[model samples]
Target: MNPETLLLMGLGAVVIIAAARWIGARTGLPAAALLAVAGIVYAVLPGPNISLDPHIVLTFVLPPLLYSAALESSLLAIRANLRIVIGLSVLLVFATALLVGAGFGLFVAGATFAAGVAVGAAVAPPDPVAALAVGRKVGLPPRLVTIIQGEGLLNDATALTILNVAVAAAVSGHFSLPKAAGLFVLAAAGGTAVGVGVAYLVRLLRPLARDPLLANAISLATPFVAYYIGEQLHVSGVLAVVVAGLIVGHDTPRSGTGASRLQTNAVWRLVDFLLEGIVFLLIGQQLPAVMRGLAKYQTSTVVIAVAVTVGVTLLLRPVWLSLTQAAHLLLRREDEGLNAREIAALSWAGTRGVISLAAVFTLPLTTGAGEPFPDRDLLLFCTFVVVLVTLVGQGLTFAPLVRRLGLRANEVDEARQRNEARMASVHAALERLDDLEEDEPGDAPTIEALRGRMQERLRRYEHRLDVLQSAESDEVPVSEHYESALRIQRLAIEAQREELLRWRDAGNLPDEGLRRLERELDHEERVLPDRRE
Candidate 1:
């Protein structure tokens, strides 16, 4: 809580996250699941434990994470599957909450219908972070990834809106379906407007954003600004963050300078790494708080409540997806329905996460008349169990399930498509260079050099295409001799870099000259694929 302790916790979290990443890579484990387990273990082991503040997580943590995800997501992919995304994000979320609420009200002792709905709303929206992390590692089909991302990006708004209404009903001892519907519509519409307005305002200030530092800074601040403005206007801040992210991400190629795009992406990756690690760890640390007042309820009650809630959460997703696919087939009559394997993967991928915990923890401590909120602690416990079941349980098994279902993407075909596009672009550029060479005789030598390099690149791409077309599997095997040539080039670059540094140190070259020369070497290295394809 103190500054010193907070600093200490921050360092510790980083170390643990680094370890999680290392272990995850080697063992094929989900980092989220591993971090969560470690947190729970630490909580029970007798050292300092951090309790999650719902306000801090909801406001400070949620915005940037959501924005980062939205920025990275493919806008075109999401739009192509907009109908399915809407079904999953909006319709599925509503259905899950209502069904869970009804079941909880009937089965859980001392739970009012409003209290049950509040808890239901908390666990309805699947968290995208864990699901995306695993899905990408396992190479899920691009369409499925887009669906998961779209659902995750937008579903929080739907669930939170429902949760707010449910909590108000519980607190005020009043409930009105019509009013809630109107409020939902108002919040959604207002949030979208705020997001669009903020994005356009940011675009108008493009002159200020040309500097890489300023651009990255503005990007970092943009989500918070959107969220705060939406909240101030009594709208859905979460939706505003998502909307802004989607729009900004789609426009980034056209709007950002090359340096700004590169720097911004690197910074956001670090932010995401730190934030996601801390969130899952905090989730594990919540066990003590969630279980504190839970003893008041019967063991059988907790068991029944958790079982029914978890069962409903898992069962409803596949059923909903199946029905939607069926409807799409029956009516639309054009788009292909998802295969059984895809449906199952998508269904299992709907794992609830931190947003659920934060929302439920925000339930009022007491009603307006000063009575204790009905079944508040019980609801908290149930919500935690739901998150654990869906997030940890499902996250840990997601990749394996996909593998068993035989749903891996065709990497070979994807690679071939990329090579074909690369070859086409190269040919177009070569044509332009020829025109320029003819028009500007003074630049003939420079143009010839450029044309020669491009033609070589064009040939390499054509060779890659031929190899891919002939290959039977996903493996892109580079010859060891070619790798040796690349290594030698890298060594030559390093030698040049060391000589440049020596010249600068000896006062023969100024720092600016050193940088300008270093950039040329940097560009050469950038052209090499340092990582495996």
Candidate 2:
């Protein structure tokens, strides 16, 4: 594409994304699904359409998306749900690939087992982005959200590893189960080692990255660095990026100044928003291109293939979740099993995204012996169709289903926990100040002032806790005293900001000096809730 066309396409994608968001907000539908449908609509009528470059998607796109999600993810939460994550991300992927492959060989004429497995692997992992966007908006339970996040983060590695092996078998006409298994173990272990190494290396160099700009720069590059290291080592690069992100995110509080965290988060949110919109739009735009090659296959064969792929992708998830929950009970595990409704939600959340399309699109045009790869275009079409069906179908319904099932998280209980914790922390600070007063009698007045403020905050937090515990609904009542304090604080900050502006306007302060002071005040003002609202 030329510069002008590329610019136009970029602009068009943003417009579509904005429209999707607006529509989704009003309709309670997923923005991703809307963007994709918009792309498909544009694909049929378009003067210009963007084709997905598999290498670009995998290298340029996948790393940052995975890394951003991982960074937002809680390491403790992921660890707590590690078993469910592994089962869904690893074991379930393997089973889906093998089962789909076997079904194709048995049922679909001219479809080889290896080729079917490759397609199966491509579509196995649910893209966490769409599900996550909707789940968070709809207030999914914390544990279920964690499971989805952990599975999405790790499943790409499993699916891609299997896809690579399946493709190699198809190309070379050689297959060894044991060798493939060993290769998988090596890839996983090596990728994990690389990810951990990269995380520690970043920590060791934290002193050099103390400058907020420098720290954010290093943070942005860490995922790509981890990806490259894993690729060079012939390991799972996706896994490497995710692991590095998780570790880095876990260390973020202690890794840099408060300024770096604020800046880094803002940057990542923008990146994620743009990339996700562009990606799903790209997925939808591929439909016309994929279908162009479908002319060579029989209609009946194509339909059968699509049916098998989509059906298994949708059905296998719920069944697997139900069976696993049952097994948890049978084995007497510590986890309280998921009820039917939770299983239903998890099942619906298995919507696929761009990763599946990217993997299938990466299929080589020809095998090692110079013959064409069997059903390459067909596989691509099926992959695209599967993404469309689930992304739109499940994405559109997931929110309302959550509401219908009444599976939203208990916000009242959560608020009470937070306020209780805050009360405890404030009490601890008061206790420490009492110790300080004994050692530093010269600062007794300052200590007393601090103690008074701490006591006041403790009282406010206690009042909030009482409101939360007694509230029957999600809304927690704020104390009038707390509201008044917040208003006074805001008023004082505004007065200080206006005085600074007066100094700048009167030529008493330089622009740079004014900006520095403004930033400090801006950060402080952001620390409280608005009382007027």
By TM-score, how accurate is candidate 1? 0.94
Candidate 2 lDDT, 1-533, residue by residue in tens: 79988888788788888888898889878999988988889899938778889999999999999999999999999998888899999989988888788878888889988888899999999997888889999889999999999999999999999999999988977655666678888999999999999999999978866688998899889999999999999999999999999998999878778888888899999999899999999988998879888888899999989988888898999999999998998999986668999999999999999999999999999998899999999899889989998899998889888889999888777777777788889988999999999999999999999999999878877777776788878745556876888889999999999999999999999999999999999999987854322
What is residue 24's positional error in candidate 2, in angstroms?
Answer: 2.5
Residues 1-533, candidate 1, lDDT per residue (tens digit)?
A: 68998899889999999999899999989999999888888899876788889999989999999999999998898988888898899888888888877887788776777777788889999997888888889888889999999999999988889998998998887766677678888999999999998888888877877899999989999999999999999999989998889888888888868878878998999999999999999999999999998878899888878886788889999999999988887797565568789999999998887889999999988888899898888888989998888888999999999989978778778777888888899999999988998898899999999999999988877876777788877655554655776799899999999999999999999999999999889978877753233
The true-structure Cα RMSD of candidate 2 reads: 2.3
RMSD of each: 2.1, 2.3
In candidate 1, residue 327 scores what lDDT? 87
What's model 2's lDDT at 171? 90
Residue 9 in candidate 1, Cα distance off native in Å = 1.4
- lDDT of model number 1: 0.87
